[model samples]
Target: MNFHRTEVRHRAVARLRAGAKNADVAREFDIPLGTISYWRHMDRAKRGECPGAHDPKCPRCDGRELDSAAYSYLLALYLGDGHIIQYSAHRVPSLMITCDDAWPGLMNACETAMRKVFPDNSVCRVRKTGCHNVKVYSKHLWCMFPQHGEGKKHERSLVLEPWQQQIVDAHPWQFIRGLIHSDGCRITNWTTRRVGGERKRYEYPRYFFTNTSTDIIQLCTDTLDRVGVEWKPARQKSRKAENISVARKASVALMDQHIGPKY
Candidate 1:
């Protein structure tokens, strides 16, 4: 609640410096995990340990420190470019990592979580095709773009790849909610959605992504569901667009209601 509490900030930084887990510190202080990470990152920047601050020409520039605005931009870039951008502009292209044995890690991680949350939900490898070009690798963070409707606020109409979009559509609530819950940061007015010129039906809705500590088991189960792919209505909605609005509204409402600033 108190965003600018210096003592809390200092204590969090100290804990991080002492090699404590960001989540642990966040849980202890009843703050969003992100707030703790932001503070720790800021502290690290002050000490000249940030990744982007690796410029020998200018050992340090305060601008390299990721303030709120920079953080949003970085998030956008990650989602839009799949964390690693290959191209942009009129023909935006990104390199989706690929490998044969890469998926085991992801599958293992997601499977573990699915068992806990939904025991009956099982993950199965449906098929394999070279033409489809299924590639997988491991990374701390991933890119995904969320979707938004007309008259709503979100990011621009950038198209992330199919797999990336599948990840988002399947688990937007989990992705955003997990971040807010895990991070101690409270987003005052953040909108993690994508906007479009017209209301056209895109096969995929959004991008699904994760942080370093994503639950592999849960992720695996969720991914299976995504692969299987179905849509359902929220309990509460109007009659105007019952079928279409349910999925859209439910997705947005969950993100908006529970995925705000937290610690």
Candidate 2:
């Protein structure tokens, strides 16, 4: 489970709690009905309808306390609409973010793609279940912007690609662990060249980086800006005796820019 999945679960739970019917919610949100049911029951338990906490049980043996049938009931409730429940592909995380605006369209695309492949609704349903074992990938991703740029823009829903997973997997702790390392110094004022060729000065501490490429530094800057943190690049020390190429520096700079500055 990653941040995006966590967000999906939370949204699902919230929607269910808001009196949305499981099927309607599932259909509307492109989530399986069983997920809706599970969250709904969990909501009830949270409100104290069930004295015992929900727990994982053995898949085998129905007559016992935590039997398959009992678990199935919970599973069915969570999924709603009698859809068979499957284990989540990964662990669920505590925090997640996703593009809400594009998800519905993506779901429709998935429905169409799946229908094309399976033709029969029953076959599609079966594939939906079995597809759990197969990796279903996202189609595309984009950012959402306010009309005329009046309001804050949010990241548009982007489909995750299988290769994106590899890129993500390449950096194990990029999300959890801070990438840029730097020292902090308090500043009463800052100065930089303005686009209009005038020197502009503002009040803030300047952030510096060492042995970091320009791209990564920019990424650090953008990330900080998003979070309302002020940042600016400082001069880099020359190690030119070793004859570093401009292209190498440029590439490093790009990657670093995306990575952004950090402490």
Candidate 3:
């Protein structure tokens, strides 16, 4: 069994030790009654000790210190394309981020961030039709990033804690890079013009970020402002969607200097 399965078993045993009925514990946790009975027997044999106590030496159970850069990147990815889901049957939680297969670097970055957060946990990758789902199994992730909630991000209120905001404030460019790599792109815009009675073409590169969450868009724009990158708000056909455009040559140059393009 994996670490997640072991954690679930330990919790079930803990509840059994707390005077909870075997049937009740099994029902609540969706575990087999036989499994609960076995846990109860083991607990009684062990003098009623709680099995949920994590091993201090096990890094997966004990966790590790958060890396500021990896965490900031993970936070931006969560705000952009990452989500957390809890399994009612097993009572296990998992964090997943789906990135386009074409951009394997972003997917690798997601995996790296997850590993940094939980140094001992395995970061699983599942390939879908066109994207790859990078996932990490741990209930602790939900505790770390409480921003994960129900429904679309735009429909809910998003706020960062003082510590998280401090990280963002300290590394705004990295945060912006993660956000842009997930939900934004850099492309060249071309236009035709008539100069001195002659047809001419002009090409310029710009960065565009679009998202459904107003708070996220605001965060992106605010970070850009902090980095001295000027941006303009663009109209979206749907009221739910918001866009930020950095088309000025100077702004694009600045972004290129800091963020460049995600591979």
Please give each candidate's TM-score: 0.22, 0.21, 0.78
lDDT of each: 0.38, 0.34, 0.82
- Model 3, span 85-137: residue lDDT tens: 87554445788899998998888888888888667567899989999989987
Instruction: Give the candidate order by descending TM-score.
Output: 3, 1, 2
Candidate 2 has its poorest 10 consecutive residues by lDDT at 139-148
Candidate 1 on 1-263: residue-level lDDT in tens?
34446677778778889999999999988889877787787678668888765322210222222122222222232332122332212122232322124334433333333233222223233234531122222111122222222321212343445644444454554443332222212222323444575454334222223222223223323533553433342233333322111124444344446343331
Once superposed on the true structure, which residue ranges of model 3 sit more than 4 Å away at CA?
A: 1-64
Q: Could you tell which candidate, 1 or 2, scores higher by TM-score? A: 1
Window of ten residues with lowest summed lDDT in model 1: 131-140
Selected candidate, larger TM-score, 1 vs 3: 3
* Candidate 3: C-alpha lDDT: 0.82
The full ranking of all candidates by lDDT, starting with the best, is 3, 1, 2
lDDT of 2 by residue, 180-263 (tens): 211121223445767587777744423233322333334334444443344434444665211111123343344345433331
Query: How many clashing residue pairs, candidate 1?
Result: 28
For all candidates, the clash counts are 28, 27, 0
Best by lDDT: 3
Pitting candidate 1 against candidate 2, the one with the higher lDDT is: 1
